[model samples]
Target chain A: MRATGDTWPHMAGAAAQPVRRATVATLPAVKMLRRALVALSLAGTIAGLLRMRGKGGVPPQEGGWREVGVPPQ
Target chain B: MTTPIVGLAGCGVTGSRVLHHLAAHQVRVAVYDPSPALARNTRVVRLESAADLMACDLVVLCGPAPHAPLTEMLVADATPVVSVGDDLDDMQALLALQPLAERHGVAAVVGAGMAPGLSGLLARYLAAQLHTLDELHVAVHGTAGPQCARQHHAALGDAALGWHDGEWIQPPGGSGRDLVWFPEPIGAHDCYRAALPDPLLLQRGFPTAQRISARVSATRRDRLTARLPMLTPPHAAGDLGSVRVEARGAGPHGERVSVIAGVAGPTAELAAVVCAATVGQLLRHPVAPGVHALGDEALAGLDLLHHATQLGVRVQEFTGVARATSW
Candidate 1:
């Protein structure tokens, strides 16, 4: 695989060992956080759907054509 | 110079839209379709057979795939061709016509539709903002027509081809889940790897890019039932769809940066606009006589996109805003 120098700028040479160790140590925490986010999003979606059921039903939004080009910065 | 007579094959959902766009532009078109339900359009001259399309200056194929035979016939006859085919195998077959197109001195553009077509063009547009572009990730949501819906269902079961580093990798279909954010109304969608032609076509254009992958947005139900036959017939025309392209590379300042951009609309209409824009580009400024993809350096991505915009396709970019700290 081609090395992503821009992505992993600090992961090079002997000085990178400590940074690599730190990254490895946080890997599990990062995974856990990601899973938690997914679960939360799923829960929010279900809640929204249930709320919609209490009302009539989901309303259809008609898509309209928008002017082309990038929005002014 | 007189305007070229363009031939259109297939009058299906997407093809019909292409005809409408071409006619709106006042382009003379000859159509070849066997369907008896084809509505009479004064702008189009109906033809009896696909062979009759060969007489036109250019032929655009929006038909169902296995387009190889018709594409071959057209290119071999020195008639330039543009195809909106998104099937992986069919796109490969079309790309294989490079030699034949070169031999006959006719240009043929393959996969000139929504995902592969607009997606590749968006990638090229983003790459221009970077110093050394290395990664391209494309995600598509929704389908255009019944044929497109069927292709999307089947693609989830076929192996996906991706370019990594310097070689190609075949990953199992429906793998590598990603949460991609598209321009709104079509917000964030859960995407997964699929047998799409975007990677192959984009690689042909940005050959130096280190990694390229393509995905399609899917729900859990969609993924679970992908291997099984469709439980229900696809809709004649699906809801609005969108294509998101993310390009990552070293920015002008040598820092890691990613640019995300997309186009959202009815998929069929987007595809038609792309096809029409490509047709206009080919007619006005002809490329070399060979098979090419929209992302190829020879084609100006910005110009094509500008033309598409004029045809009612909106291009959106993700300009992330700073989060409020106390909120």
Candidate 2:
């Protein structure tokens, strides 16, 4: 299928590589660090969402009559 | 070749995206917004009022229903206008302008955004391949953030209209509220009836279509938040969305066509591309003056599906299903 340029972010090409077998040597400490990092990232995302509370009540206009234009710049 | 100067009425989410695509295509753009400060920020030339936008080749309207007066003024001036906003509201506004558009001999393209826009056009495209269309279903699954989340809630909160047995009726659940399987990753999700204008417009455009329905689904969190507006939850769906249009009809033997349009970025960008492509087509080929929808005369010359595919809108078509499932 033909894909347009960078306009579609999800269409980005993945690195070409051969599949590799997982090693048996597992590092418990490293795995714990990874889990901690994921938890931290999740917390950060939740905080960001909570910070986005709307101002009390719907705005008088709701951008209905207002211009919702974005500047080209 | 001289660049065609196009006028833009709104610069909001979808409007701004339209401007971005138009600028990339080297189209001269003039913007008209009532707020002077909003106008001053744009790189395009700012006009004093909506009437001033009439000086351009075409006008792309991104304003609200309350802006119908401005649209009335545009059609009265014989300016071709394309609307990329609310499906139901825009349809009403276009109906009111039909007489003026006919008198002025200019065309108006309504419901040119993602769901109502591409959904209706896709239905028409598939219907053309069928000998007798029994039903058409349009479903939208979006993975968006707070901004779109609020709108989603509002849409579900409102009564949705659907076409069944050759009549318009409110579906028990506004959205279908049934399990609809979209493409992979989006997989199967619960959808509810939405007040999208596609069902109504599709029925009008394809009178033989006995059943027409449109529904929408969001991520788990967004879906829950839509039902409970008080909970401003984080986005669970990431940033991907898809619109699936399926038509069940007879072509020789019974068959069906299913099209899934996948968009990677914000839906507004895809919507902007649709509007920009429409504007480009209108500039190259002026349609007969009158009121029209996405699948109407104004966009007759445009191979909308082809243009959409070229703009990174992933389109997949599947045909030849069992007769029982065709209905």
Candidate 3:
């Protein structure tokens, strides 16, 4: 897919460089942190799903914009 | 829930990302581009002519500037349309699309991505939270490695137009400097006034705003390249983009009020998410038949804040802060 150009200035003629894949060995500390974050997120999602199992899911909004506080001072 | 037919006109980087977004939602999308290979995704129908795409419930023009011709044609067909990026930066050019949309009984949303789209919405939303609105300042910081040098030069070196005290003023790009603070990951940076569409779109939505300015800043190297043509664009910094919109007005208690909403992430992806959310609203037919800015009441008929939140775009609102002392 072509990137949207025309809307803003195009980045032309800049030197192209290949991106190196991040590896655990290259950045062990950062890799460990990312793994922990993913594990925590997955646990949270599973817990939330379990909690909502009997509640017929969260209730639908009574009014759309009302929940968002749309434009009206 | 039934999906509305969506037609995307361009397959550039931004358009490509937008296509992925719509597909993730399982919306039926047909894309038209000069090179059909651009829309070579297995999910969407790739059409060759405008004739096929015009019949869609909503059309997104991600094509190049000189949007007047195609945009006007869509309005004539009574098709609601939206454009991402800077094609409508010129007020006269965007205003030209309004009457056609009104006469055709279709809604046309201009500047519905990233800065112009999300920033405009934040401005109007903040105005709604105030008793009397006075001014608005929108600042965007994009930290890309040196690969975006040309974009930086165009953004910062070109002439800048800002709205001040009910008048539009042109200032040399990168001329006016202001130290602005943003959300974490993209802390305070020295921003300079640049000709961006957010302030203009905001002024249209909130005419009472006395001062409207849009400034853009980036990493120190990119900022330097934007100012000097001789310098080569620097290599990529860590990809982190942020935008902050500040609105100042009076609150119900007659105290000075400031409301700031900010989002930080990959700039192109953020624009696509915003564009997709806008398409989601248009599919629901909440927008009335006419032309409207993304933040205007007519367009806000759709739950923009809600749609944005659903896309995982973190939006933070700060209230009761004094503008002068805070930033």
Candidate 4:
């Protein structure tokens, strides 16, 4: 795909680098937090499914756009 | 020059909204859709065949993905084309026709829909405010129609593509989760990397950027069940959708700066306004012949945003609260 010079910009002299994979130990706290979130989400999904029994799907919500500030010039 | 008649090829959820926007602008449109019930409005002139759309000055294809063949046909016939296809593979194919479009002297705008469309425009708008742009990160929130919902489902399971320091990276989809905050009503959501075409289209425009990545908002269940068929049928039309574009670069003084801008509304409505605005721009000032994304420097991002605003799409930028001088 890189050979197709027309599609992508020529990478003058930059050499591609290998992606590094981090071990679980490198971010154990983050991993634990993610696991906790997933568990909570799973529980919530089960509860929602139970609530959905014999109910038509939730109605789509309505919304309106509100501009906070102007885009940078 | 006289007002150019626009051709519409699809009248699905997004295409039908595109028709409404165009009609609101008082633009004459020639429509051709396989489903007879899709385009029954009196304003648009219905055509019997898709090929007849070539007679119009320009054609806006809001059809399903893989619009490359029809786009090629229109360009070959010297009719400018604009496509709102969001599929990654299909966008790549449409973009590959750059040489053909240039040779035919007919412009072809690819990915003129919400994320790749409005997202690219916002990226360019923010890039213009910086001294040197280094990174661009995009997160999309919702889907428009059933077709869009299905595409979203597939994208979550496909290989994700990203641009990093001039090299392409393919990572497993449904990974790399990040929390993104959109505008009001659609606050924060968990976004994950997916097979989005934003990186591809944005890379074409901002080739020098060091990193470019895109993600779609999804739930934990969405990621877990990505590889399998959808357990539940997707909504016929999704609720409010939003896209957040974050750009990191240097300020005018060489200081680090980050700009985040977004737009939230009905995805189909946003896509429709964007398509109509691009068509309006094309009619007034035709771009050079070739495949162009919305944010390409050649196209005026600010002007396009202004046009979209006129068509009822609101753009919002995040501004951090000012620090107190003394507390």
lDDT of every predicted structure (CA atoms): 0.85, 0.67, 0.72, 0.86
**Where is the poorest 10-residue window by lDDT in model 1 chain B?**
B318-327
Q: For every model shown, what is its TM-score relative to the native structure? A: 0.80, 0.71, 0.73, 0.79
lDDT of 3 by residue, A39-65 (tens): 999999998898776555442222111
TM match of model 1 to true structure: 0.80
Each prediction's number of clashing residue pairs: 0, 11, 13, 0
Q: List, residue by residue over B134-240, the lDDT tens digit for candidate 3.
A: 98999987733232334545668667878898899988888778876666667778889766777778878888889999988855665566666636544333256
lDDT of 3 at B321: 38
How high a TM-score does candidate 4 get?
A: 0.79
By DockQ, rank the candidates, best first.
4, 1, 3, 2
Question: Mind sharing the TM-score for model 2?
Answer: 0.71
Model 1 / residue B156 / CA error / Å: 0.7
> What is candidate 1's lDDT per residue for B1-327, written digit by digit as tens?
888899999988899988888888888889998887665654458999989998999999988877888999999899999999999998898899999999999899888899889998889788988899999999999888898999999899889999999899999888998877677778768899999999999998998899999999988888898899887898887778999888888977898887778888888999989999999878888889899888888776337777887788788877653121221
Off by over 4 Å in 2: A1-73, B1-3, B34-42, B64-67, B143-149, B172-175, B218-239, B254-265, B318-327
Decide which is better by lDDT, 3 or 4: 4
Model 4: docking quality category: incorrect
CAPRI grade of model 1: incorrect
**Candidate 4 — which residues are off by over 4 angstroms?**
A1-73, B39-43, B321-327
What TM-scores does chain A show, candidate by candidate in order? 0.40, 0.43, 0.40, 0.39
Q: Top DockQ: which candidate number? A: 4
